[model samples]
Target: MTEKYRERVCNGYDHVLTIDERLYDVRTDHQHLLIFKNRAFGRVLALDGVIQTTEADEFIYHEMMVHVPVLAHGSVRRVLILGGGDGATLREVLRHRTIQQAILVEIDPSVIDLCRQYLPNHSMGAFDDPRATIVLDDGLHFLQTTHERFDLILTDSTDPDGPAEMLFSRPYYAACKASLAPGGVLVTQNGVAFLQLDEVRSSARHFNALFRDWHFFTAAVPTYAGGIMAFGWASDNPELRQQEATTLQRRFSQTGMTTRYYTPEIHRNAFALPQYILDAIGKTSP
Candidate 1:
């Protein structure tokens, strides 16, 4: 039998992965979803012909996304996650004992249901945690209508295209800003800076206009297909991004949590952007 493969083309680059076994493939109401097993990445989930997450390196993305803000803010009791239906982000957030509530807003219920069935390890029972509240609604709508403010908000949306296009817009960002509590922080998935510099640039422009402090941080997730992935950081408290390594270490230690990729040193250094990325985002410093 011939080997089966799947390819994703983005920003004029093509990334191909061999499919060891096909688990599920269907068109949900929102988008086309596929799940398969790969020799190296374990289980891989793709939506609309783009790889969303893989078991192998998801820790890198999820940890950086959840921990960096949580540990930096140092007193995040309530968290709102937008579009992380896969539940890994929720799992990471629930690890913090300080977190009292974690509300996840997802547009597509099928993504959450199917991910729970097919990508069980990705969530690792996060959906069942008492602290987790799953809301099946569009993120923008939830942000606009909800009066509850969160200490931290993480937008784990897919790339700025298709069903997720509106998530990267200025209006969506403004809604997220409005939903945050005082001293809160907002982080967004800005895609890979090498190929998706425009996404970073757009978010940077919006963040700059909306907040007293704004920057982008980089992390390398192998399955994301580009060189370095950038996460948009925005907050009125500039000092949250400027926490000393020792302070971060202290906060992390108090949580009694173990992380694979996110450390105090890594957290501090992730903010240091390369020259090209800095130029693209129109910032001299991260």
Candidate 2:
């Protein structure tokens, strides 16, 4: 009993000590955020009450969030991010080098402070990049107020609760739609396609109503249960898929890089809905 009490995680999520000495369970937001400390993967991340990620797993989340939609848009010069405090998203967005500017609007500044202090690898030099600007505010409010448009907008958010709820609303979708450049693309975490399937379908439908070329997709991360996760992409026009002339090369070559998941072709397959998702899309009430 003493051993169990000593080692057991206080949070509801199922995380065991990876290095025991390195990464330790700290606390939880109950059904939401599971706070942990690690020698890797950085700190202050929320896993959906299942598995937690290691340092290596964080790369998949960062890559998928920043890459797929941006590449689909053909060229992303100016970018906007909502709620990605871990800086993993910021790190990946900086890769193409063509990005003139990137704006990261995160509600809780503490999250960034934690990750920056503990998870330096996750963010690289994103916080110091001259082209990247970090704003501390509610993202939904930013969408409502910011008049300037972007080539890509990536929503890096928590589960559909707490501060992230409004980010999934139809009004928010409409606001984001209005706040984009003509050929801009938007991508968001739509929650798990397995458990939150209904919510995912509903959110996709609202996005579809707001944008012309829309797709729902998935990526796997070991920390995010079964290493499975979901995302939705939307754009103003179908031309995004046709590929426009861009200064940066659109195709991704894995010939040298170490990526556990996500590739150019994988981007296309991620949108292939499971049979249930196809049926539930229009039926789900927003």
lDDT of each: 0.91, 0.70
Candidate 1, residues 1-286, lDDT tens digits: the string is: 6456555556467888888899999999999999999999999999998899999999999999999999999999999999999999999999898889999999999999999998887789999999999999988889999999999999999888887898998899999899999989999999988877889888988998899998988899998876999999999999999999899989988989888999999999999999998888676862
Scored by lDDT, model 2 comes in at 0.70
**In model 2, what lDDT does residue 68 have?**
75
Q: How big is the positional error of residue 243 in model 1, measured in Å on the Cα after superposition?
A: 0.3
Off by over 4 Å in 2: 1-44, 47-54, 242-250, 253-260, 282-286
Q: Against the true structure, what is each candidate's TM-score?
A: 0.97, 0.80
lDDT of 2 by residue, 188-211 (tens): 887667766766877877977888
Clashes of 1: 0
Name the top lDDT candidate.
1
lDDT of 1 at 91: 94
Mark the 10 consecutive residues where model 1 has the least summed lDDT: 2-11
